[model samples]
Target chain A: MKHRGCGKDLAKVSEFIDGGLPAAMCRRIRAHMDDCRPCRDFVASLRRAMALHRAQGRAPSPPPLAKAELRDALRSCTAALKKRKPR
Target chain B: MPESESALISRSREGDPAAFESLVRRYEDRIYRLAKNVCAGAPAEADDVYQETFLTAFKKLRTFRGGSGLGTWLYRIASNLCFMRLRSNKRRPFVAALDLPSGEGLRLPADSIPTPEQAAGKRELAEAVARALKLLPVDYRLVLTLRDVEGLSNEETAKVLKVSVAAVKSRLHRGRLFMRERLAALSEGAA
Candidate 1:
C-alpha cells in the first residue's frame, strides 16, 4: 500500500529533517522525494530558512548590567537561603 | 577556575551562597536568551522571566533529582515563567495565515556559515523572521525557537515545553512552514 503521496511527504519534510519518523516512514519520504521535484525544493528552502534563523538569531550575550543584576539577585537569593532552614 | 556544575550543586545544596552564585554565573546568559526568545523579542518581559526563572530555580534546587541535565531543568523553569507572563499581559495582535506554497522540490546547497555579505542579508532575514514568528501563537513560537533556532533536540524541547515529542514535532513542522512562507515573501520583495 502507498504510505503517503507527495502532499503527505511535503508535510513530513521537517519531520524528516528532525528524524522524527520511524525508519520505514523515512524511507517512504525519501522515495517520494526522489520522484517529486516540488517537495524537494520546498524541503531545501525550508532548510535554508531554518539555517538563516539559527545563524542570524544567535542571541547576543546578556549585557553586563544584566549579569550584574543576576549576580546581585543570586547573592540575595543565597543569603535568603542561608537564613532559612534546609528542607 | 569555576567549579563543575555537580560540585556547585552539591555546595549549593548545603546552603553555600558562593556555590549558588557560581551556578547562576554558569547559566545566566543561556537562561536569559531562552527567556528572550520565549517572550518573542520582548526585552522587558524577557528580563522579568529571566529573574523569575532563577529565583524559582534557586528555591527549588533542593528538589532537583538529576534526572535531566541542569540546562534542561533551568530551561523548563524559564519556559514556564515566560508563558506565565505572556498569559497575564496583553500581547500585540499578530497576523498569521498567508497563502504558502505547498511544495517546491529542489536540492539547495547544504548548510554553510554565512559570509560577510550573506551575513548582511541574514540580518535582514532575521528581522523578517522575528516579525513572522511574532505572528504565530505562543506555543508555536516557543517550539520553533527552542527546536529550530536554539537547536534543542525534540526530546529536550518536549521536556522544556512540557509537551510530548509528537507534539513538539507537530508544532515544529507547522511553525517552520509558517516561517518559510513569510521569509520567502520577504526575500522576493527585497530582490
Candidate 2:
C-alpha cells in the first residue's frame, strides 16, 4: 500500500472503480493497480466505503405525526376562523 | 405519477384531510430520504428538515399554481428545509462519531439504520462512506445521493435538482471522484 499517485492518476482509478470507464481503460487501471501498492490501497478504500454504504442506509423512520393530530389541528384552526367571522 | 399526486394535491387543497394524508403517505418515504441524504448523516437534523418540509408544504399547498409536478414541488420544499438545517451551524454531534441506525433490506425500519452485522461486518465501513459523503458540498451531495443511492435516473434527478442533465453528469462525475477519494481514505484506515 506504500504507493503514490496524483488526482489525475485517480481519474483512471476512479473511472475503473465506478465501472464508468471503457474496457481498454479498465484493463489499464487493473494493470496499474496490480503493480502499484498505493493505487491498490486507494481502490480498497473506495470499496470499503461502498461496503459501509451498503450496510448503513435508511435507519430511522419519521415518527408518525398521527392522522388525528393533523385532523385536530385543522379542526381547531377552522373553529378559530369561525369564531372570528363577522356574521 | 403526475396525475396521481396532482389529484391528491387537488383534493388536499380542497381541505380534504384524507387527501392530504394520502399525499403525505405517498411522499413521506421519498421526502424522508431526500432530507436524510441532503443532511448527509445527521438524522436528528434530517428529522427537523423533514418536519419543516411537510409543514411548509401543507401551508403552501394553496399557492401551487400547477406549474411543476407535485413531487417536484414537494422536493423543492424538502430540499429547502435541508438547506436551512445544514446551514444553521447547530454544532450537533457529527453522525460520523455515533451509531447509524440498524437493519437490512430496502424497505428499512422506521427508526433504525442497518448495522453492518445486520449487513455482516460492513457497518463501520458504511458509516465511513457516509461520513465521506458528508464532506462533500451540498451541490454534489444532493445530486449524488438522489441519483446513485436513491436510484433516480439522470432526467428525474435533474428535474428535482433543477439542473441540466449535462450539469448532473458533471456534478455526479466530480462527486463520485470525491467519494472515491474518501472511500480510499476510509479503507486505508480499515486495513
Candidate 3:
C-alpha cells in the first residue's frame, strides 16, 4: 500500500503500455515496476481494462432508419444551398 | 478511379449535392459512433449531434483549409457538438478537476488479475465497464472513447480535443486508471 515513491512512475505506465515512451523511459518504468508491487498490479489491470474495451469494437453504427433520416435531411439542406448559390 | 476525398470536398464546396452526400456517407458511421459514445445516456442527443456535425461541415466546407484530414475535421466538429449538448442538458459539468492525484484511489487486488478471456465471457462485467465509462467525467470519457474505443491515435485525439499531446496523455492515463479501479471494485463486489 506504500504509494509515496510510486506516483510519478505510475503516471507514465499508460504511455509505457502503449509503447509511446522512449526505450530508456520504458526501461526506467520496468525497473520501477520490478520493485513496486502496487504499481505492477495497477499497470496490469489498466492494460486488461483497455484490452476489454478494444475487444468490444467501435460503438454501434446508427440504425438504418436513422441513416435514412440523416440522408434525407442532408439532401434538403444541400438543395437549399444550391438554390441560394444557383450553381 | 473513385474521386479522392479532396476532390469530393472541392465538388461539395461547388454545390454538388451528390458530392456532398458522398462526403457525409464516408464519415457518417464514425461520426455517429463518436456521438453515441459521447452521449451514451441519450440516443436522441447522439442523433442530433451526428446530424448537426455533418450539416455544419457542409455549411462550412468552403472554410475548410485541408490542414487536417477530412476525418479529423469531422471529428473535431462532432466532438464540439457533443460537448455543447452535454453542457446544455446539465446532466454533467463540462469541467471536472482533471488534475486528479495519480494512483491515490482504489488499487487492483493483486490476486484478481483480469484477463481478456474472463472479461469476454462475463456479460455483467461488460455492463459494468459500460456503466463505469458513462460515470466518468465528460473529458475523461471523451479521451477514453477516442483513444481506446474508437482507436484514434494519440495525435488524432489531441487534435479532436484541441489539446496538447501531453494533456491527452494525462487525461487518458487518469481515465484508464479510473476505469481499472471501477472494474476491480465491481469484480470484487460480484465475487
Candidate 4:
C-alpha cells in the first residue's frame, strides 16, 4: 500500500489529512510519513488550518428572536399575505 | 422554538403568532448562522438577511408546495437574502479555504469562550477567517456558508438553492479551495 498509494504524492497528503483516502491509502500515507518530513509537516499544518476553518464553520447560535419581534414580524407577514389574496 | 417543521408551517400559515414564534425559536440559531455566513459575518447585514429570510418565508407560506424540508427551504431564502445584501453593499468576494482533510466537517469543536485576555486572539482568528470568506463570489459564499458552515448536505443545499447536485458539489469544491488558500495566507501572515 505504501509503495502504491495514490499516484499524486502531494494530493495524497491532502487526502490523507482529510481522511478521504481509502484504508489502503491511509496505511500507505502512514508508512510514507514515517520517513517523509516535508509531507509530514504539510499534513500537520494542513490539519491545523483545517481545524481552524472547520471550527469557524460550525453552525452559529442564532440571536434569540424575542417574543415581541416574532409576533410583530408574523403580524406584518400575515397582513401582507392577506392583502395580496385574491378577492 | 417550533418543535416540528410541519407544526410550525401549519401554524404560521394560519397566522398563529405563537406558532410563528415557536418556529423562530426552533430555527433562529441555524438561520442566523446561515445568514451570518452568507452575509460574511457583518452583523448589520446578517440581521437584515435573517429578518428578511423569515419575513419572506412567512409571507410565502401559503404558496409553499411541501417539496422539501422547511429548514432547507428557509435556507434557500436566507442565502438569497445574503446574495442580495452583498450585491447591494458592494462587498468583495471571500477567498479563504485552508485545505483540510475530508471527514473534517464532521469534527466540529466543542464551544468555549476565551478568558478576557484570550478573547482578542480568538476573535482575531475568527475575523481573519471571516475576512477571507469575504473574497468568495456571492454564489460560492452563500453555498459554502450554507453547506459547510451550516452543516447542510449537498442534496439539501442543491434543493434549497434550486440547483442540481452536481452544481452544488462544483460550487462547494471551488469555494472550499478558495477558502483554503485564504486561510493559509492568513496563517502565514500571522506567523
Best candidate according to lDDT: 3
Candidate 4 per-residue lDDT over residues B30-103, each given as its tens digit: 88777676666677778777777788877788888788877877887887777677775445544443333331
DockQ (C-alpha based) per candidate is 0.41, 0.24, 0.40, 0.27
lDDT of 3 at A62: 81
Considering every candidate listed, which one attains the maximal DockQ?
Answer: 1
lDDT of 3 by residue, A14-85 (tens): 888889999999998899888876677767767777776555435677888788888888889877876787
Q: For residues B68-166, what per-residue lDDT tens digits would candidate 2 score against the true structure?
A: 777778887776666666754333332221111111121212235656554643455556656876776676777777766666667777887788987
DockQ of 4: 0.27
Which has the better DockQ: candidate 1, or candidate 4?
A: 1
Total clashes, candidate 1?
Answer: 9
Per-residue lDDT of model 3, residues B39-102, tens digit only: 8657798888988898899889989999989999999999888778776443543332222222
Better of 1 and 2 by TM-score: 1
Q: Give stretches of model 1 more than 4 Å off.
A: A1-4, A83-87, B88-120
Model 2: fraction of the reference interface contacts it also forms? 0.15
The candidate scoring highest on TM-score is 3
CAPRI-style quality class for the chain A–B interface of candidate 4: acceptable
